[model samples]
Target: MDARYAIEIDGLTKRYGSMTALDRVSFRVERGELFGLIGPDGAGKTTLFRLLTTLMNPDEGTAAVDGLDCVASYRQIRSRVGYMPGRFSLYADLSVEENLAFFAALFGVRVADNYDLIAPIYRQIEPFRTRRAGKLSGGMKQKLALCCALIHRPSVLFLDEPTTGVDAVSRSEFWDMLAELKAKEISILVSTPYMDEADRCDRIALINEGHLLAVDSPRGIVSAYGERIYTLSGGDMYALLLAARRLPHVRRCCPFGAAHHLSVDADFDAAACRRQLADEGFADVALQPAESGIEDVFIKLMNHE
Candidate 1:
C-alpha cells in the first residue's frame, strides 16, 4: 500500500495441483526502480509476473501495484502496467503498425498520444511498419513488442525474459532502450536466465525452484560469497572435475565455461591441490584464485537451498 513502492508482494504463493510454482515469494520494487528477477527456466519467474500483472490469481498472500491491490483493483492495474511475456504474443497476421495501433485502441488511447514515449524504440522498426509481425526477424519483433507495450504510457513495465532468443547485438540495444525508459521514471521488473544481465539492474532477486535465495545489488551478492573460489583447468576437464571433488579441502567444484570453479576452504593450499591432481595422473593441471561473480553466487545459493 506504500506509494513509494511501484510493486509490493508479501508471501505470494501459487500452485497447480501437486506442483507449487511459487512458494511464499516476497519482494518489493521501489518506484522508478529497475529491478531484475534472475533465475533459470521453471524457476517460477513467469508465474510471479502473471500474478503481479493480474493475469493469474495466487493461491495465497497478496500483491499491490502503485497502491492498488492486484486482485481487487485488477482492472485499474491492467491499465497502469505494461507486460511483455517471454514468448512473442503479438498478432502474427498484423503488420507492425497495426499491432501498435491495436494495443493503443485496446487501452482507449491513440498512438499519437504516447508518440514521445515510444518514439525511441518505434523509430527502429518504423521502416518495417508494413511488414507482418511474424515475417520480421527476432530482434525486430522484440522492438515492436516493446513499443506496443509502452504505447499506453504505463507506470510500470514487466518484461519476462525479453532478450531470450535475440542476438548479442539486439540484446545490447534492448538494454539500452530499457536504460532510457528507466531515466523517464518508469519502474521496470525484468526477469532473465542469463546471469551476466544481473549486473545491469539496480538490484536483483535471485530465485530458484520458486524460492527467493537472496535479494540485493549485484555486487552485494558477490561480496557475500563467503567461500574462497578458484579456477582449475587442464587437458582433461572431466577427469580434473572428478579429482577436484575428491579433494578433502574442496567443498564444491562445478564447470564454469572452460574451467571448473572450485570452492575450497580459506586455508586450502593451491600447491597441494596441484600436486594431488598430478599424482592422480592428470596433465596440464592449473589452479589460480578467481573473483566470485553473480553466477558463482547463484550456483552457491542453489546448492545451499
Candidate 2:
C-alpha cells in the first residue's frame, strides 16, 4: 500500500472457469503518470481495467487505486476514479449535454463545478450539445464521453481503448486531450492496440495472452531488442517474405508497411543475402539495416513466449 503510487497491483489473477484471463499480472503506475497498457484485443487489458475500477473482482491477488483497496474500499475508489470503457457506453438516446449532466448528477456534482477542467474538451462538442450521442460521429462521441468522465474530476482516469474505431484526426486530438489532462496531474491509464500510441506514453506495459511481456519507457523497450534487423523491399511482398524466412541466418521476418523486417543472427551477411535472393529469381531486391520499433519488440517477445 505505497501512498506514492496512484495505482498498484501484485500477482493479480482472474479466471473464467478453466480460462485464465489475467495471470499473475503486476505493475505500478506513479501518480500523474500517463501509463499505457499496450496489447491487442483479448490481452486482458479490459479485465485489468475492470478490476482496478472496482467494477469487477479479481479471482486472486489484490489491487489498490489512490491508496484505496479495490475490493474493500470500492465505494471510495469508485468516487476517486473515472473510467471510460472500450465501447461507447454512454446513453445513445440522450443528447450530449444530457449525458454530461446525468453523469455529473450521479457523482453529486454539477458540470459547472468542473467547467474549467473540461472546458478545453467540451468546447469542441458544445456546439452539438443537443445532438443525440448516437447521432454523433466517432470522434464527437469520444469527446462527449471524456467530458462526462471528467465532470467529477477524479484523481485517476482509466480509458480502455478509447481510440479504437476512431478516425486518425480524432485519434490525434484525443491523445492531445489526454496530454492536457496529464498536465493537470490526473493519472491516466489508457489501453490501446496501436503500437504507435505506445510512444506517446511516459511508460508502457506490453502484454499478450494474459501475460506481461515487458514494462518500460518506449525507448527502453526498443533498446531491449538484441538482434540485428534489416528491411527488405522491391520484390513481390509475399514471395520476399517466404524467401527471407527460408534463409538460415534469418530468425524472424514479418511484413512491415511496404517492407519486410527481418531479424538475423550476428553473422548475417548482407551481400550474401541479396545474392541469394537474386539467385532465387527475385527481381529488384533491396535490403538495408533498420532500427527496431515497439512492434518489432512485441513480435520478438511473443515468439519467445
Candidate 3:
C-alpha cells in the first residue's frame, strides 16, 4: 500500500450465490480525504463499503484500511474504522443517549472519553436525548446514528447513504459536518445516490450494476463529457423531445429538471435545432447551453455500458 492510501482495494469481487454484486472493483482513498462511492441503488456501493468495513468478506481479491488487511486483520480494522450503515441499525427502543453509549461500550470506550469527538453532532439532538431512537425525526435519527459511529474515535469513517431520507436543510447540515470532520484529518468514505453530493468529495468512483464506470474528481468526470449539452424547455416537452430527436445531429436527449438536456454530434447546430422544433409546430421552444454535471456523466456512462 502506498503511504498516502488510507483505503486500498484491488480486484475486489463479491457474489451472492449466482448473483454478482461486485466485479473486479478497485480504487484507492487517500488519508484524510472525503471520498464518495456514487451510484444509484443496487450499484454495489453498499457491498464495497461492507467489504472494507469487514462486515462481510469478498469472494476474491483483497483490500486494506490504514495498512491492515480486511480479511486477516478484520478485528484491527473494525476497531479503527467507524461505520454508519445505510439503514437505521441502532436500537430503536433505546433513548438517543443510550444508543450512543451502547456503541461506545461495545467498542471498549466510554461515552465521556470520546464525548468531544461527537459533541458537535450530538449537540443538535441533545435536547432529544431522552427520546427513543424510533420516535426521533429522520434527520435526528441520522445524527444519532452518526454520533454512535464516531463515539469510538475511529481513524476512518464509512457512511453508507447517511442522507437518504433527510430533509434538504438537514442534508446540507450533514455535509457541513463532514467538511469539519475532514478538517480533523479523519479519512471518510461516504456513499450516496445523489449526484450533487459527488461534488463534496475530494474524489469519486462512479459505479453501476456491479461494475466501475469512472473514477475521478467530480470536475474531471464532468469534463470527460465529449459533447456539448443544451437544456431545451418549451410547451409540450414530450412532443418537443420527439421532434428534437428526429434532427440530424441529435445524439442523446433526456429530461433534466423542467427541461430536456440534449447531447449533439459535432455537426449539430443549435439554431437549426430551435428552428426544427419550431417548424414541427412545437410551442415557444427555448434552448440554452448547459454544463454537464455528475448525473449527466453517470447517465452517459451507464448507456455506454
Candidate 1 regions exceeding 4 Å error are none
Alpha carbon RMSD to native, model 2 = 1.1
Stretch of 10 with least lDDT, candidate 3: 220-229
- Candidate 1 global CA lDDT score: 0.92
How close is each model in CA RMSD to the real structure? 1.4, 1.1, 1.3
Error of 2 at 179 (Å): 0.8
What TM-scores do the predictions have? 0.96, 0.97, 0.96
User: Which regions of candidate 2 are displaced past 4 Å?
Assistant: none
- Could you tell me which residue pairs clash in candidate 2? none
lDDT string for model 1 (171-285, tens) is 7778889999999999999999988888889999999999999988998888876468899997888878888999878889999998999888777889987888888898787
Error of 3 at 243 (Å): 1.6
Worst 10 residues of 2 by lDDT: 220-229
* Residue-by-residue lDDT tens digits, candidate 2, 1-305: 98799999999999999999999999999999999999999899999999999989999999999988999999999988999998889999999999999999999999889999999999999999999999998888888898888999999999999988777777888899999999999999999999899988999999998999999999998887545889999868998899999887888899999899999888899999889999999889889999999999998998882
Q: Which one wins by TM-score: 2 or 3? A: 2
The models' CA-based lDDT, in order, is 0.92, 0.92, 0.89
Q: lDDT of candidate 2?
A: 0.92
